[model samples]
Target: MMDMQTQPVRSQSRPVVEHGFVTESMTDTCAIVANLEHCTNTAVALQSHYAQGFLSSRHKHGRGQISYCQSGMMLVMTDEGTIIVPPGHFIWIPPNMYHQAQAQDGMCMLSIYVENGLWPDLPGNSEVFHASDLFECLMQRMIEIEEKGAFSSSTFDAIVTLIRDEIGLASRLDMSMPMPRDRRLARICNAILREPTVLRGKDELARIGNVSHRTMTRLFQTELKMTYSEWCQQALILNALARLAAGDPVTTVAMDLGYVSPSAFSAMFRRRVGCSPKEFAKQY
Candidate 1:
């Protein structure tokens, strides 16, 4: 999981400090620590407006990336799987991993790129991390530093070290929505994904691809290693998480997602997320 701290922010073109020592409890007393003259080991950047419908061509970087979105969501697609990063979550991408990004709405993002040898014990694959309050604060502070092209400082190194340690032991969630590359299965999968709540069941869904229900079911199992029902469940849950992040009421979201009743949806949500939908939505 990701984590965050802080208070009223002090606005300024450049962060100025009294003694250059930072505090976690009060933002007025804190400054977005200036960066290092040379961040060769961990280059950082920020995208304040990941605009609606944002899309990136497939690409790879030589450095590992740690990305956090303080608002909205990010969809990442790679050979291994597809990852959904909603508000209050973070995403990590290993160096040289070919991937593309899609955003349905605007997002505020902070990305730190670590030189290969400086990655430490972080995972080698992309991870969608649940951002904690502490990490949220840190990301904001980090972003402030990255915005200016020339704000380097010694304390910046210390901050990077803390970020590395925090990620090493943070909680992990099985939040990926893996997809098959097969043309036929991909077509059906995309249809259901467009409107996750309107699925007509496996038997009828097979018609989208002009295939027999049995064949479609087998194809899902073989290519994605997940049954059709399992895939649907995964899609629905991902949609629910996004809606909750947008501040939708639990009851309304449940009903809109086609749950028979709020209680039934709550049970499934709790089983899958280990918390009530109400509790989950409060993260933002």
Candidate 2:
């Protein structure tokens, strides 16, 4: 993880009226974000801290957002799925996409919002990607410039270009679990999310969804583009990430996720995440 400390800068924008969207009631960070939407600048960067359990209610931005999780973990919930943003990772949200963000173990996030059409080739859907060291440095520079109110400076423009190019080159991580659109499959998937540790076979899950096993298999491939088992493993990995980020022991997370042993879980986690759970947890 990027081991850097940053002071949260309060938004200078005036208080916004509560419109059942983003309000002061839903974490101060969300209110600051609400104000940034109207800024005329091509891009705006803000640093905010959120307490554990802090949640930003469903909201949409007029501009695309790149939210870097500097500390703790964040889950960005969208209609399609949940994207896990662990420490040292960031999530890219396309313009006008409604989503909710929840913080785990408290969070310090640096968000950069860019105007629509500013980067015409940016991904249209949400994605989570690891933040490289160089990318982090550029982001830090951008934040510093934003703090100094130097949006029009040549240096600021150069930094913005570099940051955008860095983002374009960053590899997207498989830290997301896409949800199925069918109500029956969605119900089963939600149940699994609620209790990822519970063991169930394809037939059992299909029965729960009131669909035939073959139909359930077809739905998984058609909607999520993965097999049922693959989806389950992904759900387990995501849930394990959240628990592990919150300081849960590897053994405990593995057991909770129904892994027969910690080593088994660690091996699988390493295969998927490129690091052992212990190494990943050390960041937090």
TM-score of each: 0.76, 0.83
Clashing pairs in 2: none
Tens digit of per-residue lDDT, candidate 1, span 1-284: 01001112223344222222222211111122222113443555443355555665567767677878777777788897778876666888888788876664566666666667687577777887766677777766665665453355565676777777677656666667888888889889888887888848776778887889889989999999998888888899888987887788989989998887999999998777657888777756
* Clash number for each model: 14, 0
Per-model lDDT: 0.68, 0.77
lDDT of 2: 0.77
User: Candidate 2 on 7-82: residue-level lDDT in tens?
Assistant: 2334354434221111222345556556767567777766667766666657887888898888889878898887
In model 2, where do residues sit more than 4 Å from their true spots? 1-34, 146-152, 255-263
Worst 10 residues of 1 by lDDT: 1-10
Best by lDDT: 2
